[model samples]
Target: MIRWALIFLVVALIAAVLGFGGIAGAAASIAKILFYIFVISLLISVVMILINKSKR
Candidate 1:
């Protein structure tokens, strides 16, 4: 998931450099959304692991 975000970010950068404003904007937004989702999932997983460890 994080890798995909990075891919989109790179795509956005390339598109922008090529003067594709619409494509760049769309890719950037997708990347941003993916990044946030990845972060939230990571945090949730960490919290879950900590909780389980503490229970043991």
Candidate 2:
């Protein structure tokens, strides 16, 4: 997921450089959303790990 977000971020940068405003905007938004999701999932996984450790 983080890889995908980076890919989209690269695409957005390329598109912006080429003057593709709409494509750049869309790609950037997608990248932002994917990044947030990745962060949230990572946080959840960390919390789950901590909880499991505490249960031991």
Candidate 3:
């Protein structure tokens, strides 16, 4: 997921450099959404692991 976000970020940069305003904006927004989702899921996984360990 993080990898995908980075890929989209790179695409956005390239698009911006080429003056593709719409494409760059879209890619940047997608990258931002992906990054946030990845972070949230990671946090949830970590919390779950900690809770499970503590339960044992």
Candidate 4:
């Protein structure tokens, strides 16, 4: 997931450099959304691990 976000960010940068405003904007937004989702999922996974360890 993080990899995907990075890929999109690179794509956005390349598109922006190539003068593709719409494509750059869309890729940037997608990257942001993916990054947020990845962070949220990582946090949830960490909390789950802690809960499980405490229950042991």
Candidate 5:
């Protein structure tokens, strides 16, 4: 998931550099969304681990 976010980020940069405004915007937005999703999931996993440790 993090990998995908990075991929889209790079694609966005390349598209913007190449003067493809629409594609660049879309890719940037998608990268932002993916990054948020990845962060949220990682946080949830950490919380779950903490909860499990506490239960032990």
Candidate 6:
């Protein structure tokens, strides 16, 4: 997921450099969304793991 976000981000940069404003904006938005999702999931997983460990 993080990897995909990074890929999209790079693609967005490339698109912007190539003068594709629409494509760049879309890809950048997607990348930002994916990055946030990935971060949230990672945080949730860590919290779950900590909670489980505390119960043990």
**Candidate that would win on TM-score:** 2
lDDT of each: 0.99, 0.99, 0.99, 0.99, 0.98, 0.98
For model 5, where is the 10-residue window of minimal lDDT?
Answer: 1-10
Q: Looking at candidate 4, what is the lDDT of residue 6?
A: 99
Give per-candidate clash totals: 0, 0, 0, 0, 0, 0
lDDT digits (tens) for residues 1-56 of candidate 1: 99999999999999999999999999999999999999999999999999999999
lDDT score for residue 17 of model 2 = 100
Runs off by more than 4 Å, candidate 2: none
TM per model? 0.96, 0.97, 0.94, 0.93, 0.96, 0.94
Q: Worst ten-residue run, lDDT, model 2?
A: 1-10
Residue-level error in angstroms, candidate 1, position 42: 0.6
Q: What digit string (tens of lDDT, one per residue) describes model 3 on residues 1-46? A: 9999999999999999999999999999999999999999999999
Query: What's the CA RMSD of model 5 in angstroms?
Result: 0.5
Clashing pairs in 2: none
Ten residues in sequence with the least summed lDDT for candidate 6: 1-10
User: Per-residue lDDT of 3-56 in model 5, one digit per residue for the tens?
Assistant: 999999999999999999999999999999999999999999999999999999
- Per residue, candidate 4 scores C-alpha lDDT tens digits across 1-56 of 89999999999999999999999999999999999999999999999999999999
The parts of candidate 6 lying over 4 Å away from their true place are none
Error of 4 at 25 (Å): 0.2
